[model samples]
Target chain A: MNPFKTIFGTSAVAAAALVAFGLTAAAPSAQAAEKTSFKLAWSIYVGWMPWGWAADNGIVDKWADKYGIDIEVVQFNDYIESINQYTAGAFDGVTATQMDTLGIPSVGGVDSTALLIGDFSNGNDALILKDGDSVEDVLGRDVHLVELSVSHYLLARALATLGKSERDVTVVNTSDADMIAAYQTDDVTAVVTWNPLVAEILSMPNATKVFDSSDIPGEIIDLTVVNSETLADNPAFGKALAGTWYETMGIMMSDTEAGRAARAAMGKASGTDLAGYDMQIASTKMFFDPAEAAAFGASEDLKTTMESVRTFLFDHGLLGDGAPSADVVGIEFADGTVMGDESNVNLRFTTRYMDMAADGAL
Target chain B: MTRLVNRHPDRPTRLLLAMLPFALLIAAYAIGSDMRLAENPNDKLLPSFTALGDAITRMAFTPDKRTGDYLLWVDTVASLTRIAGGVAIATVFGLLVGVSVGLLPYARATLGGFLSAVAMIPPLAILPILFILFGLGELSKFVLVFAGIGPFIARDIAMRVAELPTEQIVKAQTLGASTWQICTRVVLPQMWPRLMDSVRLSLGAAWLFLIAAEAVASQDGLGYRIFLVRRYLAMDVILPYVAWITLLAFSFDWLLRVLQARLFPWFAPEGASR
Candidate 1:
């Protein structure tokens, strides 16, 4: 017999006995089978810092306690691995991008709902050229990037704007950890990556930003997404996440001393100083105000933006094999409209929770 | 300490003993997998054998739709080629330096401590330097594996040569052997089995450097494929690839043992365990 089986069996029986005793000893609650625990995963990024900040400052616990639940926020070093773990059902929710949320989980047959559109990349993801003036100047140069990531998406978009396809330049698939050192070499002249690496590269002499995600606003969106089934089963999870986000965002974006301290904590969490984090947050078009985020979520602008994102994902074969069309995955907007295959829609943009937060109902 | 010696077990008993731990590990995994899947059928952490089999079939038998290549075979070929190339070069160079520093007093005094220091430096610390100096290509990966294990191999060989009996050198000298003959005919013959042993031990470190280099930057390799699928939580693929790597390494180790035993039978004592 496995050792874990023996231990887990005894403990499981003991826990079940304790739960039965507690239920009989206490009064019945309003709702039956209410889940009071969940796990949320987040990685280091400009927009997603609020999750870590809220967890560290007891804001997550505060919001979770309001709904009589416990929320544990986990941090992942690698961006893609967090999403993978979420898709594997190891996490109840995760901070992901519009592109990754579609390309990975949705394509992998895990239905996820975009509960909150945290922010979009204004100039966060950029294309930098060494000794080059414009994007067109990178015609024959080799481009280094974390392939199949948003940087790759940004590179394709930049190339399209330059009237050149991927064939125009050689792409060197590099890891994010090595991108900085790879660029330090004279051989790597062109690189498409996200900040703060972009900030670090730009600090070098003669480096120019040829293009950035800001050129196409509302395209690169960061979101806090949860499993569709998990959310539908427990509406409190969505409420707790939204409440925690807005509360943290409000404090971090304020002009108060407390806000500065909050921002400093966030900066330190992301391995940067206060000024560096402030600059990154400035580049990131964060939806700090709940009302603005609610309006943005409900607006038709979101639908149009997702249409472009879905098109990009499908065009790049990220929607999985035999997609038939760009509508391989259904995307629900805030206005009760669905794009792609409606019956099989997976990427949902729901504003009910955010709207409630904005209306001060939470 | 009390000497605890036992007679060698019979063939069947020895075989059972060898297979016991592996059998227990497999059984433990099978039970754990069943329990996890029973709780959650969608669990990807501990995939069932069928899932791993399916992943292996997909990677090894089928061609990827996008790339139109058998990824498992391609990765194996690429990884083996790099390991073979790196190990081959390291063996030749390690043997030369080891013999030179072992035989000549001047060479030993000048380079012995230097090579020891080189062996102490962590190879992964200089991975960025390798990439910067050699670019993110096969050359960088090859150089990383070579540099990572070469010093250790040389040091091991030098230690073996230093421990050689002084009587052998005196005998060779009294036989009117030239300095070159004394080094080659007398010393080189004795270092062959030891060199093979050093190479076998260094294979582990060589693989470590190869995987580190490949994981940092590479378009194709077993390490690259493992990391690429890791982003999807494809433990089915990752686990099977890991098993495959273990099998490949084991095969190489067994082959080297066989070669050593066949070519240098005199190195072993009769009725003694390996």
Candidate 2:
């Protein structure tokens, strides 16, 4: 018999094949009619490690079970691509820095809400100098970093301490992947980068951390942001995500063997050992307690940090062509405080989920 | 009766025919851009032509506010210099070593397996090693391009050199030509076209290594610019840069083709078996 005979001559076989594929495809949707499923995207970072831990240790599953929903965590090798995926609706939520959350997704016109304020960079990001000790010494020097990224923003903020600006020093746009290698060269005198590259460079001889995110506290905040439309439709998603995060944060910050084991695992995942991961954690001001995060989200300091971020973004032309001023994209904080144009609020820093987590309502 | 095999296109018609595919591609892209824009005016996936034009103008024409450099020209010059340096060094090294290995039995016994082993070691895998050894500078980028494509060029030249008629070498020796004279005078001239053609074939890999190296650790280059704007999802800038790179690569390939034909008119590239 010819192989094409069965395929071309019989509608019966075709119908059976169609039924098989259709049933398989429809099986999940049938079960999901009452229940729900969501995907969360995360990348490697000290603050973002909890997402990995929660997903691996079944904490995410536990919360999803409690809420009668399904949650899957996805990891991306590239940080920006993770956020891009979340913005393009591939994932319901993503781990991102405050500026990146505002710059790419919010400014790109994706309405997103911060489900949880995970942490802020303390000394996680640094401006390292090969020979110098002060930010003033960066004068007439090429500071290598990824251009238009948070590192560039950190450089700007660092230089501002000495009453200088980005123009005072030349920025040699280098990738984070090559940050440690580039610094080994005699030509690269200064570098602005985040951990674990910061940790790697600091371990090297003659590398001095001149300035870091600690100086400008709360500016480089990290959070898990969810699509506004998704969260609005399914409040269970926001609750489960926030609950899972704080629970994982509790374990990560604890002194138990489980906590130590979790850290070790995260260290291994991020291509480091326990001590190196701890070093990164020391520079990261993670919000293990939901109460502290809520307060931070509600504080006037959040608004101030956002203003600087928006201004920096506008200066870099990241606000898109429709934005005439920095005030075009609205940012809404907790307690009814809205920054920028209230008519178009794309990024909302809501403390509601964190408050619920704190009050044990979640 | 003559059919498709016998259909020979005239030179003018062939030139016009090449424009059709490009026209079709442009039309398809325009339609995609229009449909996407109609759905969402702020879509970055497929930007409108006006936005792309503005991005190109900004990059190529306007002096950057901070550095005060014409960015596109600077990037082009920097990338071109690295490629030229890498290819030139590889060419000289390839010719000398390839000629020796092809002609001398001692040279073949010593370097033949070594060359093949080196070629098998993926250049990208050793990129980190290159950075560590040479430091992350232009030299590392150049060496990466060399390591990636140098072996390919060398092996081809060696094969071509080996395939050279034994009669020519015997006749040269019979006419009182020394081994060195036979290599430089007879084999060298015949393989020049082959050398250029191999380099032309290896340009894609050369560009890959150059872009990868630049993307990793350069201040100013086409790759650096594209990656720098990627964080912002600036597809308008990225697509144009990609198009510019393709245009540059195509021009290089075209020039090599023209040069091969002009300089070695008797060499038949069409008869190349591999």
Candidate maximizing DockQ: 1
lDDT of the candidates, in the order given? 0.82, 0.84
Q: Give one digit per residue, the lDDT tens place, for model 2 in B1-274.
A: 4554566667786676557546545655676666555544566656789999998888899987656899899999999999999998888888888888888889999999999888899987766678778877789889999998888788888888999989999999999999889988999999899899888998998989898888887788888888878887888889988999999999999898888888887888574433
Evaluate model 1: give its lDDT: 0.82
Checking candidate 1 for backbone clashes, the offending pairs are A330-A345
User: What are the candidates' individual DockQ scores?
Assistant: 0.28, 0.27
**Candidate 1 chain A, poorest ten consecutive residues by summed lDDT:** A23-32
Give the chain B TM-score for each candidate: 0.95, 0.94
Scanning candidate 2 chain B in windows of ten residues, the lowest lDDT window is B35-44
In TM-score terms, candidate 2 sits at: 0.89
lDDT of 1 by residue, B1-274 (tens): 3222434456886676567556655655676666556644545566789878887888899997667899899999999999898888899989999998888889999999999999899978887788788887788888988998998889988988888899998898999999899988989999998998899898888888888877877778998878766755668888999999999998888898889888988876472434
TM-score of every candidate: 0.87, 0.89
- Name the lDDT value of residue B44 in candidate 2: 65
Q: How many backbone clashes does candidate 2 have?
A: 0
RMSD (Cα, Å) for all candidates, in order, is 5.9, 5.8
**Candidate 1 lDDT tens digits, A225-266:** 998877887899899999999988889889999999988888
List model 2 lDDT by residue over A89-153, tens digit each. Answer: 56778999889988987876678898899889999899999778988888889888998888999
Clashing pairs in 2: none
